[model samples]
Target: MRDTASPAPERRGGHPVATRAAARLDRLPPSRWHRRITLVVGIGAFFDLYEIFLGGVLAAVLAAQWNLGHTARSWVIAAGFLGMFAGANVLSVLADRLGRRRMFLVNLGAYSLFSLASAFAPNLSWLLALRFLAGVGLGAELVLVDTYLAEFLPRAVRGRYLAYAYTFGFVGVPVAALLGARLVAGHQLLGLDGWRWLLIAGALGAGFLQVMRRQLPESPRWLVVQGRDAEARRIVAGIEERVAAETGQTLPSVPEAENVPERRVPLGEMFRGDYRRRTLMWWVFQVLQTVGYYGFGSLAPVVLTAKGYTVTDSLLYAALGYCGYPIGSALSIPLIDRIERRTLIIAAALGIAACGLAFGFAAAPWAIVAFGFLLTVCSNVFSNAFHVYQTEIFPTGLRSSAIGIAYALSRLTSAVLPFVALTVLTDLGAAVVFAGSAVLMVLLCLDVALLGPRSTGRSLERI
Candidate 1:
């Protein structure tokens, strides 16, 4: 077992209270309280992915309704990505400044409110605009959740707990797929178009989350860094009481930790030291990873339609493929803490690339679904693994902003990639499109494997 006596080199010129608060937070073991936190936070993530995956399925239906060509179809899919790009970069900077709990609620409200408006869109342009607005919340919500989980969870089982949270989030993938399958079958409900009904479902779920989130406690670590030591101490004390009651054991003494100063961290700090190299690495990974992951996800149904599947049949198959997401996350739960995080990310990426090659060549229904399922499974494993890895490497102060910028690149590339992928699919073929995905995955594997930090057993301060 790794020793906890020394987490990192002690820093000078730091507040004692901030150090004490960080120590208290880093000392707790897993409990029902943590599970509750995950459930509450993870549910919002459900709607984020729900709106995204559901939008992909709706692309074809909307295109048919508007008599849009392939390029317009690509725009229908890309617009939300564009909005997400802006949201991740702009709103995430505020998360570290404003507090995770407050931003979580605000982002949720943006997502839920806009999704409701999206259902009422009278023209293609209105739908695209509303979805773009909704995408903003989706973008911020994802990075903040990763930031929250990393801070709240201790280093020992951090990856596993994160995997569990994402496993809950991944459950939405299958739920979205099942919902897509249902809408394709039912056609409509409450006199609205079937696609509009899908948007309503995401909106209602997010609305309920806003009410549920009121009970959530703010991050003690965040409170400390902001010089609100009294509040941070009170929060940790309550957590200690609950943990003690659950475990029926007195908690061990917390190791001494150096204070993480409460100060204004400029956005430019990321490009200034070792963080500069780290930032560049994630930027490259995010750009390439998005092309392989979302490129296939958002455009797969459209390609299938062009290959002669009816709209309903294409959605049914896509829904089945989406099931792989949760299954992949589930598989990672045990191995996440046990294996090296970068190792898993690299391995999963290669598996996904290999699966992509097969998916492009497969023509039979069973073969196509089989390859797609395999691809999504491997893709999500990489996703859950890296989400934990990314948050762990950065300081609490820089965590949200770092990921915000990285996720923006992920979304930005995804926004522009649809046009590229569709053009390739339209001219060259499905094989070429997926072959392109394979090449990007290879690049991602090299970037992460060579440059990513080892974080599983190290404290956040040490990492």
Candidate 2:
């Protein structure tokens, strides 16, 4: 029999609240609530990805208008990455302390407000400054997505759920490319620059998202970690009740608790003991990943323009080729639950390497677009798994901080990579630039094959 004064001791999860919350969450079937959360959260990510890609298309526009070289345009891109570095490292910490829902709202406002202001920028200097400020919110918003979803989802379908949401986000790439194809054609929209109109459109979208976010519930796991036992139970109970109604069946009994005590864990804890090794692994992984991802995404159109395609052809072809991103990522939805995450990551990395090499060597436009499409498909395949892997490796108390710190380090590399990619593409050529990317992908494949954890179908606490 259980003790009357205190609940049955859950040795693994440590606290009664955490044990109950995790049990209930893991046992419930997917319901309308799950889809609703995924849609709202995914929409926020859609806007963020759209804006990030828009920066690239807009860079192409500004390059001609401002008579800017690839090197100068790199600074325009670098400013956003540098600001994201600060935002991810700094504001992300607040999510752990202040609460996820509040920080989510604050970051969205920060990003959209600055983005709207950027539309009015009179010169390159002002545009750069506004983009940098917007990046602060951009950075934190990403971390929160990973943090919230990991906590809300059940272990059985967590990986697939994230992929579904991420699929929605990857669509933003093609959408941006398509929109840019139309918007970049002229300065005829109320006499405002097309790029300015693009920025304003993104800001308006964020405002609509802010209203949608009002219905989101707090993360029960986070509440449990904060020692707010009653609140966590209430949230979990409400969710369980809804799931029961949807399934028309009785809920499963709570699983045996994993005993992790409720205590105040300090930030420094992630850097010591077993987590020390994990932190080092994630930091290296993130930095290399960002260099490969941002380097390619931000500069693909520019490279096409450099290669003798007319500006119109470059943007249009880039749009056509990037249509593969969302489709490729959507492929992962069926596979994520069946395949081990580390295994899938390694496989996708190899595909990226192969496709990137082909893209670099192809001289014909058809070949370039064909190979570029393949590369993007592989990248998004890699991305869906990669985003989920980082948050899975850490404990709840340190989850946001670890992701934030590693993400910050990654953004730091991304901040520098625009300049690096520009220099390499100019000095060496596309073949050599992608050769470097291929090598990085090979290294990532090996690292994961050797050091990465097995996370599929495992509880967040257990992983």
Candidate 3:
């Protein structure tokens, strides 16, 4: 499970200290330091997804309990996504301009408080408002995790490690699904609805993680970008010492740092020159991919209910299917760094398109379970590939902002997709909704195949 860093002969960055810090990181083998960081950050990601999918799980039950129409149901779900749009677009830029660790904790704290408040909401409007505010905190979390990992992890294992973090994080999906299936209708504990208990659990869990994450060191690469070479060097040296002690292996010598042009790329740099095409491709991919991913993912329980399954049956089926989120992510860990990220993305997306279509028409319980499992597995592989891909293609200066802006649009799609998918399912059927999903996945596959950059086994700066 250990990997010795074999840094490239030459690397590029804004400062020589940052370049050397990156090289030193690349030379250390995988150790407790990487795992600790990955696990710590993964916990935050777990809550992010738990909160995201909890909305869908709650939608059907709340609709029934409150006599919510389709429009009202859509608003309930869309509220969080709308907040995510603002948080991601705004805080992501601040991560780049400010420090990654600062914004990371800030967003986590914001959501944890609001999510707990949401559990006590007196009405639908209060619940929606709290969810929106909590979502603002949820938005920048994953973005920062990605930025942090891509900066610190050795290039040799970067893709796989990110997959590893997400594998643990994706476990939240199944946990949420299972909780929804069991608790959404059960007797109230502590004089609260079962649904309210779910929110409280997520909020409390994230709050604990926020405290644990204070031990995380800021990204030395980011520190260098801020012209704080002494601090960057100290942090990198401390990490190297810890990794060396844990691995008990003689570290390889840090490769000679190459001096590339050191000017900080402007925030607008993503829209110009070589980056423009990448930016456009990311934007388009974000929009279309959300329709395929969240369309089925965030709305599966409701879609099942719309298909005539009872709330219990729908949640149970969703729980079974959501198991694939972690399974699929785990499966990707071995192949993620080995395969070209774009190729993996294209292949998994195609699998999603096919499995989604099959799941749409499946009637037998066995068939439903089979296709749902396959679809989830494929989607996680697709997710793992793209999550790593997006971080790799952008440099340190533009990574957070570019990803934030691009991801914000996906939140927009996620916000509206419920209404769109629900409208389609109501007007036509589940089959049509999935048919549309298939088309969107195919379009996304084509987009990546055509425009996505090759980022396999490459350093962040080189890409």
Candidate 4:
């Protein structure tokens, strides 16, 4: 492939050195170096997804072991999300102030250490505390992933590669589900309960991921934003050389881009000027989308149990449905760069609304699995679009902070959603729960269709 530079002028928010560095990195064709970076980041992210879905499985096991009621079970689920809220808002601020790579390492270590600690918790209270701490670490993860990938990847292939990375990460969902089904069935590993084994495995995997992440170069775009232009030039040059050697071709010339003076953007800058509208749009989108995405994911076993499945049967069925996460993400890789991001989110939201309703009313076993699978597929497609979309809208100066604040709201919704969702499920029934989701999706579709910017094929600085 002849890699051509994006015609979008990289104006505002960066110096000429920044513009040149971004242009050089963005003009290179996708190569082995890019793929390796994608895979490493994706694998690290796999543990985050594992932890997210792990809550659903663990909630079932803990309930059985402790004989907890609806409210208690809701607490078990909400603890991690609440921690995530704190992590996303607090640690993400550090990511912008400190550096993407520094916060990346910090959050991963926090999640891993706390997860290991949670496995040893002797009671519900301790478990909740540990999970919250772990979540604080996890909160910054996906936010960092979006910020990091957007900074490193070229414009032409940015959305597609981001989808590819998340596709690898989403594989953790079904794996956690299947493992939960098998392990949670009175199974043990290393003399611990199956559920404990799951937490341990996630922590151990993250330990290995930390080692892999050491090989990754910091984002040159970020370095430029930090006024470290000399270092940024060196890193961009290395990237260009490696990509050229792998592609066995001369690299494209860097396109002309406007140079704006670099300065530290204040945290409050997200709610001012053009960013205020973008921030509000993202906040609304994040809140509603969480209700649609994690609403089903966090409550999968509960939803299935409501339909008369035993706990064991619910886990098994949930495993089958979770298979759609990776499958749907993989299927969307080709379409991510091709379609307008907002359009994909809108279409995917509608799909979730439709499939979620069907899943709610499904009686027969086969029907449940089918609709569950389709619903998850749509959820992942929606997930991929928004993850990439949010990062693209903000400049490097505030990308991490903007996404963190916006994404923290989603975590907040996830924290509170279980209580609300479960209460609705208990009162009105499962169909009404999905009907509520349908309304949220309709609102999301309208929000994006009206307010979302066009991001496909545009450079990060330009967007």
Error of 1 at 308 (Å): 1.5
Query: For candidate 1, lDDT tens digit of each residue in 1-463?
Result: 4323222332435545656666666788778888888878877778877766665677777766667887778878887888889889888888888998888888889988998999999988898899999998788888988888777776777788788878788777667656665776447777887778878888888989899998888887778678776787677778888877887776767776655454446788889888888888899999998877777677778878877888777877877887898899889988888888899999999998999899888888898899999999998888888988898777777789999999999888888888888888889999998898899899998998777888777777767
Better TM-score candidate (1, 3): 3
lDDT score, residue 10, model 1?
A: 29
Scored by Cα lDDT, where does model 2 land?
A: 0.80
| Over 4 Å off, model 1 | 1-16, 258-263
Task: Please give the range of 10 consecutive residues that has the lowest summed lDDT in model 1.
Answer: 2-11
Candidate 3 clashing pairs? none
lDDT (Cα, 0-100) at 241 in candidate 3: 74
Q: What is residue 210's positional error in candidate 3, in angstroms? A: 0.6
**Candidate 3 lDDT over residue span 1-463, tens digit each:** 2333333233344336566777788767888889999999987889888878988988988988888999999988899999999999999999988989999889999999999999999999999999999999989888988999988999999999999999989999989989888887654897888999899999999989999989999988888788877787778778877887888887887666455433356888998998999999999999999988877779989888987888989999988998899999999999998899999999999999999999999887788888999999999999988999999888787789999999999999899888888888899998888998999889998898899889898767667
Give the local distance difference test score of model 4: 0.87
Query: TM-score, each model?
Result: 0.94, 0.95, 0.96, 0.96
Worst 10 residues of 4 by lDDT: 2-11
Compared to the true structure, candidate 2 yields what TM-score?
Answer: 0.95
Off-target runs (Cα >4 Å) in candidate 3 are 1-15, 261-263
Cα lDDT of model 2 by residue, 1-463, tens digit: 4311123233433445676677668877787888879878987888767766776787787888888877778877777777788899888898888788888898888888999999999998998899899888888777888889888988888888888888888788888877777877565588887778888888898988988887888888888789887787677777877777787777666676566444456999888988888887788788777756666677778878778876667788888778778888898889888988898888888888888888778879899889888888888888888888887888888888889988898778877887888789888888888889889978877777777788888888777
Error of 4 at 224 (Å): 1.3
**Candidate 2 Cα errors over 4 Å, as ranges:** 1-15
Per-prediction tally of clashes: 0, 9, 0, 0
